[model samples]
Target: MTQQTENRTPERGTHVYDPATCRVGEFQGKVGPHAMLRPVGGGREWQADPGKIRRATAPERLRAGVKAANERAGRML
Candidate 1:
């Protein structure tokens, strides 16, 4: 872990936005210099700088939840 990663505290299920990739994910945990994030609908996880992470807005969270629900429904088939 690096000093910068320790500076910011992230909560579990913490929603974050990545302007660089125009993507969003839930903060799972911190690893080294990056924060671990899992996709909203259960895809591969990615690492990102904690410094650049920002909390997702209400609309974003709602959209993610709906997407996850739909994905799960599809998997039940």
Candidate 2:
């Protein structure tokens, strides 16, 4: 990772993709060296390497939104 990438810290609530876990989550904040992220529509938060995560793409965000919606609909059944 370049120095810019390592120093770049996204603002809170921005959606970021963690390639290590192949998951998209909202940037909560940094915890020590790890960047914390919470799943879309709310769920458990996980630690991700700051250098390994980037802002989520449009389609990835849509997929996550759809999944959250489907999960909510399922619970309503």
Using TM-score, give the best candidate's number: 2
> What lDDT score belongs to each candidate, Candidate 1 first?
0.78, 0.89
- Residue-wise lDDT of candidate 2 within 9-61, one digit each (tens)? 99999888898999989999998999999999899999999978989989999
Candidate 2 collision pairs: none
Tell me model 2's lDDT, rounded to 2 decimals: 0.89
Candidate 1 lDDT trough over 10 residues, lowest sum: 1-10
Candidate 1, residue 45: how far the Cα is off, in Å = 1.6
14-71, model 1: which lDDT tens digit per residue? 7877655667789898899788889897789998878877788888788888989999
Provide the TM-score for each candidate, comma-separated.
0.77, 0.91
Total backbone collisions for each predicted model: 0, 0
